[model samples]
Target: MAGFDIGEKWPFALAAILMGATFFIHLVAGGRQAVRPLLADSGTVPLDARMTLYYAWHVVSIWLAFATLIFFLAAFRPEFEAIAWANGVMAAAFGILAVVVTVLKRLPAAMLPQWVLFLPVAGLAIWGAIR
Candidate 1:
């Protein structure tokens, strides 16, 4: 990885921050500022099984965002090519997690998670961009 740019992966962290900020903005604009509903449940599905699946999705996304943070570090910190390897693995992990959650809960592969989940995803994406 000679000649690899340290700045290549920077800006991820900024993307993450923007994501979290966007959620707050949307929540305030929508006039639904309750923490419990935003965080715990959204009342979208009726079945307990569905709810569990839904929550599982949220949990995975949360973790993915955290992993994305690590990748972002590579960009900002400019580690060796090993950072690329770590980020690549994280990317695969996110994909697998997303697919598994979608299939287990009978959710469409392209489906969007509830608002709560968006915040973290946005945060991760933004963080990636800024880092």
Candidate 2:
């Protein structure tokens, strides 16, 4: 029960909450707005490409859920701290990639605001890992 001290591990808990929320938002809103529309474009998009993108979207959903679980466990289990660190690094990478791609495409920040959702999760998880 060494790391079961919830009061001292609030950052990991908060990161878990944020990541869970992001997962749900991605599952519900992103599915409705982006996934469905992309799939619906059968006339313009090729079958192989559409299916590939759909598969990738599901992969993200799975990763988010897995990260949420890992961070949540890290809040109570000290051994999972390393996994949390890895997740934080990946989250930071995702955030940076989103920003770079948005800028490269000359799109408005609002159009690709994934960094907003990702960076805080990275920060919190990393903070928890060090503390």
Candidate 3:
């Protein structure tokens, strides 16, 4: 926090914080409301503790890793432009693909809102990387 001036990079920092919060919210609340029910009714062994653990672990790990990485990039924006660009491109592509998939699948209304959350993250990352 010493070398990083929050005022100078508030947009990226705000974006990072929003992204982190969104990831956390999705991992917990959204997962419960959406993923848990799907997983439960998938005809898989609902009582399989190991399967549940494995699934939770996979989801949490990816969510935390990506969110943490974005925070790191926000904290060190100038030094991490290449990393930012790489992540930005990936995030942007994923967002676009998710939108397309959602439309093609005619996913639930809730899904669109969830996917829309990533656009700001992608925008901020690309903005920070280029600037």
Best-fitting candidate, measured by TM-score?
2
Worst ten in a row by lDDT for model 1: 29-38
List the candidate 3 regions with Cα displacement exceeding 4 Å: 1-4, 38-64
Give the poorly placed runs of model 2, Cα more than 4 Å off. Answer: none
- Name the regions of candidate 1 deviating beyond 4 angstroms: 6-35, 38-70, 76-80, 110-131
Query: What overall lDDT goes with each candidate model?
Result: 0.49, 0.92, 0.65
- Candidate closest to the true structure, highest lDDT: 2
Candidate order by TM-score, decreasing, is: 2, 3, 1
Tens digit per residue, CA lDDT, model 2, 1-131: 95368687788999999999999999999999999899889669889998999999999999999999999998998889899989999999999999999999999999888899799999999999888
RMSD of each: 8.1, 1.1, 4.1
Distance from true location, Cα of 85 in model 1, Å: 2.2
Per-residue lDDT of model 1, residues 1-131, tens digit only: 55445455544444434444543453454234333453455466456855565576556446545544554455555452354344444444555666677778998754623334443444444454444
TM-score per candidate: 0.35, 0.95, 0.68
Model 3 scores a TM of 0.68
Q: Tens digit of lDDT per residue, candidate 3, span 1-131?
A: 56556556565665677677766776788668756666666555455764776578567548646754665576565665566556656667767878888889999756656456567777876776555
